[model samples]
Target: LDQIILNLVSNARDAIEDNGRIDIKVSTGSSEDILEHNSIVKPNADKYCLLTVSDNGSGIDEEKLDKIFEPFFTTKSAGTGTGLGLATIYGIVKQNNGYIFCESKKGRGTTFYIYFPESDEKPSEKQLIGKETKPDEQVSSTDKKILLCEDDEGVRNVLSKMLGAAGFNIIEAADGEEGLRKFKENKDDIFCVVSDYVIPFKNGIELYEDITSMSPDMGFILVSGYSHDVDNIAELNENRNFSFLKKPLKPELLKRTIMDIAKHGND
Candidate 1:
């Protein structure tokens, strides 16, 4: 919910070149009212929470509305976005047992409504403080082997070098298919699979599934420029041992994620 709100706000800000209005409204609606008025099925009895974000910027066309939630689908220019914002939000909300609806008309405005089932359970509060690390302190990799899969050559090179410098033995693959092949060949030597979500042949999720079947205890990390339906990733994080890092990730973040995986070995 927090992530989705951030993405929507960021997108609205980008759409408006100058000053514009963005309205965020939250309320509770009865199940009957929601079903009749919003044309959405209520997940439970009584009431549900409704969150609506409206922006008075350039509105989307009707045709594009359906595609906005798809991974890598974007109207923005190259280097502007990875088109994973909405997709990621969609995945998150669904995972949390929620639903979303969007409305827009060209030259008017756009509004997104998110519905979440009401719960009597109190929300748990936990504050995450960022780990402090010194710049001079090098992250050691302990001769552990890693299967690195990334389609972009530039990103691939930088990541491989960074991991290699940390003392990891890097086995590189350009796409998912190659990643799987390398994993099979180096099953004994490899300590983890670091892969990009979007790739050729098969996707990161599919690769994760295949690798887990062969080596259930293997560690995996998924990196992506945009967000997607991360239910599988979340499940793996909960049931097995894996990590996910969003793209444009700093070196420190990557190091921390790897170290976390190495230390904990999943829940």
Candidate 2:
């Protein structure tokens, strides 16, 4: 769910180069309405949670709209895009039995509508047991500072708020370049770095390599919405100072990982 929102919003923001608007709406949708956009739905579910992301920018050409969700298919020039964002979004939505559709015109604008089936089942006893727990008290407070690197503003803001409410000082950066710069500036004070696996300028691995070279004992947590890349990083698994998490993040898990790293920073 987080990945869907992050990638869609990020793409919309990028499309709007300047002085453009992006709108997000969430509402209930019916199977009949969703069938107009997607044909694969089995129609076993009657209701869905509709997510709409729209941008008033230089829209896409009809010819390219069909290929937007294909891996490595990009309209942007050269090194600007990997084109995996939309593919990832499509795969995630489909994996969860959801439907995604896009509408665009060359000069008008673009809008993406996603339909996720609404489950009527209530939470189980196991899930309900911890429903009232306080997230802030789940992990011990630390005097150490954390470096947060993520390109999407919305994701970053939510993460910052979560960590801040847990009583930790946070230093934020929008990309790997700025993250590296800030790490160099406050290398002495930072206790751990929580960064997205994929970021601009440099990736998480590069940032981890650079920072670990300078401060070998620095605690690092690498996160991602994509799972295919996780198996390739054998080093992250071997390193005692490093950890990885998949999104959408579980707040308790993130907080516990950070606190564990902080408590055992010198070990």
Candidate 3:
């Protein structure tokens, strides 16, 4: 819910150029109302919670509304946006068994409607337990290390926390060059390398090549916000030791990938 609200509000702010109004309203409605709004039948629920975010800004083009939820589809200038915000919102909505619809007019304005099944049950807090470690992942060595290379500090910290929670020792670096150097220093103990495609000094692919030259079977995962970035890395397909993940990564997916690599020896 926090992610959905933050992304929607952020996108609304970006759309406005001047003194524009952004409105957010939350209300309760029935399933019949939802079906009328999107014409899509959702799971039967007695009541639903509706969230509406509307903005009077440079609205999206009618044709582009359909593609707004797609990954890497952004109206912002290059380098200004990753185009993952809306896509992330869409995924989150769907994951919660919710529905989302967007209405926009080029010059008039834009509005987003999100619906989630209302639950009367009180929210329960549950501890998050890490997945069971596969037998193959339990190497004789005490250290289960992952070399994490990401330029963004926030993203780096988040990934670090996630890996750390999964019982992996994290060696962090801000860029490709630092990552490579760290990998070399810890080469004997490092189990996997997780890196972003674009970074200072050297790119992810170059880093992959340099490290693989010495350890051909080194487990590596490359992450990128742009799909084309992965497509351009021909070495990825040829190397069984390497895998690529598109940005806006989910924690479960990341952990699963690492476990798979560990269990299979990156083969």
Q: Whole-model lDDT for model 2 versus the true structure?
A: 0.85
TM-score ranking, best first = 2, 3, 1
Q: Look at candidate 3 and give me any clashing residue pairs.
A: none
Across residues 1-267, which tens digit of lDDT does each residue of candidate 2 receive?
766776777677777867889899999998998878777756558999899999998899999999999998987778656788889889998898888899998777899999889989987997878566566434555567899999978678878888898889899999999999999999999999999988999999889999999999899999986657666667676888899887656666898899888768644
Query: Which residue segments of model 3 deviate by more than 4 Å?
Result: 1-44, 49-80, 91-97, 100-114, 118-142, 231-235
Residue-level lDDT tens digits of model 3 in 1-267: 756765676677777877988899999878887778767675568688999999998999878888999988998878867888898999889988888889899877899999889987865454245456667566432367899999877568878987788778999999998999999999988878999999999999899889999888899999887668765567576677688887666666788788777767643
Looking at model 2, residue 1 earns an lDDT score of 71
lDDT of 3 at 207: 93
Regions of candidate 1 where Cα sits further than 4 Å from its true position: 1-140, 265-267
Worst 10 residues of 2 by lDDT: 133-142
Clashing pairs in 2: none
Q: What residue pairs are clashing in model 1?
A: none
**TM-score top scorer:** 2
Off by over 4 Å in 2: 38-42, 122-137, 140-142, 149-167, 172-181, 195-210, 222-232, 244-260, 263-267
Question: Alpha carbon lDDT of residue 132, candidate 2?
Answer: 60
- Between candidates 1 and 2, the one scoring higher on lDDT is 2
